[model samples]
Target: MLTAERKRKLLEVLQSEGKILASELSRRFGVSEDTVRRDLRELDRAGFLQRVHGGALPRTPTSVEHKARQKESTDAKKRIGAAAAQLLRQGQLVALDAGTTPLAVLDRLAPDLSLTIVTHSLPAATVLAEHPRIEVVVIGGRLFKSARAGVGVATVDAYRLLRPDLCILGAAGLHPEAGVTTFDSEEAEVKRAMIAHAARVAVVVASEKLGTVAPHLITPAGRLTHLITDSAAADDLLAPYREMGVEVVAV
Candidate 1:
């Protein structure tokens, strides 16, 4: 298995079992004890686990924090962000979806560009607040505390009034057959509104989210005009999206 897949599986095992012995993991995965220990240490640094003497234990359960999630794939997100930012034009109105990848796009936005940005993401709004040239409009609605973004009917109503030039859609999953899906139903509604209101839709996804499907369906594969991802995405996995006429931009 690839290292990323192995590490993700290791984390899943630790989460499911509460604790995992290094020796057991080494034996199960056919890897050395030293390799298991190294993996445990890396997971510890990522705040996913606590390394014990010869094993690892699950970290304390806590609500997912938006800022913490944004820091997870900093480099890959930056590349995706830069690529998304390049798609923007001066004086165009755009809608940015909530999530770490889109927030990265907000970070890379040029301060001197004249544009209007509409978003329900608090982090995205906060980042764009620093820019003097960009007009940042925060969609007011009931806040989803875990995501630190607005959702529900009020946010959906706000989106109906403004038709944007582009919308940067975030994804929990982007399967070839399943299309785009999210973890929450309300978030899915919000994404659907974003898709409907924008003239063109661009999905900002990390490599890991490529094949994974969540419970909530947002839009079909054909709705997206562009797919922006990192270089870590597989060619075979991206082929379906390309076949559907979606321009895949791997950063």
Candidate 2:
């Protein structure tokens, strides 16, 4: 088959099977392993797939732009956010990560909850600024436009110093083995710092991210204190996290 045809088929197989082995692809396409590897490399650079050690995984939702991601899983994110917000109480110091999921959590916060929120997320800070009972601290840094959040040495340093009662952290993928992944390295650094100092780390992500792995890791799934997802997640899908001692809260 032609290169374009082979790449398209590869993506199709990867999406259907959730991963691709280079050896298997070479045999199936009647192409040399070198040719199959070259095609995979091209697809990876095009953001069509993520090449792993001996195979490829689907390109994660984080590969898309921030605005685009906001539209992809609206309802699931809302449920997750509401569940995460319910975990909060008065007099808590919380760090809100950048993303629509965090915004959903902000939406569900009670007007009288009375809390201080520290964040590097521009959007999360904007919503918190209008809350009557909440104190908002915006972490300053160079804007990471893709995530529409602050990222840089300053962002990482600030999170390292503050020990928040909880962190409503961001994540691109939450896999059992690959751990908590993000697409961007800088975003990963920021998330790593947040996870390091927080008393509890909670992630509000859709069920789609449950078993997927992204390019950069923030922390292992075992390090997480809580995993809040939509009810659509299957029992098997959540089992790994639960086995790791993560409190699984499916809303």
Candidate 3:
């Protein structure tokens, strides 16, 4: 087939599947692996896809709307959820941050695992309410409509009285240099308080968040005990956290 024809086919496949392995594409197209890589590169350059280790994923917008964002990249979130859920055990008090990723973690939680969960996330509180064994504590404060989270002086004050065994943080960005950050200042304060009050902190991020830095800084990389992301995360990208004594788990 012509090069243009093959490239077009590759784009179609990648669009439908949401991801495409280089080797598989090469085999299917009867082309060299280098050619497949080059095709992926071109597509990535055109903003059609993102090149992962051995594959390409459809280019997703970072400014995704809240409801749509919840469904996008679900497989990766599920894997991350499984890894995060494994960290929980009976009789431990946990704090779940409000975000699409943390909500995914709630879905994977074991029904029989008894724990007290303190959260300002309305969605998380609703999910935890249905779990018979888990005790849910909703932190009260002025509600943030966009994020569906409560954040204010009241929320921070309430958090001070309870110390959690673990805090599962959902971040907007994770820069090796900038540490962890979020877009909203109030949310950043809440996250920082959660980090301070929890015995351990786990930052859950998708691979795309690794190199990106956001406006509001929350905590430094050293504060986290663990960083959980998808298996697609590059080892070199996560090495800095590992070097800082933070356990990095790729789900």
Candidate 4:
């Protein structure tokens, strides 16, 4: 088969199975492993798929631009944000991770309650600024344009000194085994720092992220204190996370 033909078939398989293995593809295509690897590389560079160790997983919705991400699961994210917001208390410091869902949590924050929100998300910081009783602390770092968030050393260092009562994080993928993951390594570093500095960590996920695995692991699922997701998420999928002693809140 032509290289293009093989690539087309590979994409079809990836779309149908939601993942692909290099060795399996090589055998199926009657091509050398190196040739299959080259095909994977080309597809990855073209934004067709996310290449991982031994296999490739589907590129997640979070891999898209911030605006595009916001358009997906709009109502479900609002419910998740509302549910996660209930965990906030007056005078407690909170870390809001970068994502539309985390920002949604701001809409539910009580206007009369006093709180401090520290975040690397530019949009979240902007929204929090409108609340008179809320103090917003924006982390400094190089901007990750697609995520509309900051990453790199400056962002990580800021979180190092913070001891937030809770960290409401967003994930590109949330799986029973793979845990919380994101596509960017720098974003993963900042997320790890937030997880470390917070007394409790809650991951806010939309339905699309559940059961998926991204390239960069943020932290293990067992490390989380709470998992807030939309009601549309299946109980079967959440069972494994609950088994780890993490509170599962479906809104």
Best model number under lDDT: 4
TM-score of each: 0.74, 0.86, 0.75, 0.82
| Highest-TM-score candidate | 2
lDDT of 3 by residue, 91-118 (tens): 9999899988888898888778988999
Give the better candidate number (2 or 4) by TM-score.
2
Please report how far candidate 3 places residue 185 from its true position, in Å.
0.5
Clashing pairs in 1: none
> Tens-digit lDDT track for model 2 on 133-239?
99999999999998889999999999999999999987888877667888889999999988788899998889888777789889988888999999999898899
- Superposed model 4: Cα runs more than 4 Å off: 1-49, 54-56
| Model 4 pairs whose backbones collide | none
Model 4 C-alpha lDDT versus the unseen true structure: 0.88
Winner of 3 and 4 under lDDT: 4
Displacement of the residue 210 alpha carbon in candidate 4, Å: 0.9
Candidate 1 vs candidate 2: which has greater lDDT?
Answer: 2
lDDT of each: 0.83, 0.86, 0.83, 0.88
Model 3, clash count? 0
Error of 3 at 9 (Å): 31
Q: Cα RMSD for candidate 4?
A: 3.0
Model 4 agreement with the true structure over 23-82: per-residue lDDT tens digits: 988898888888988888898888777777776777665645789888889999889989
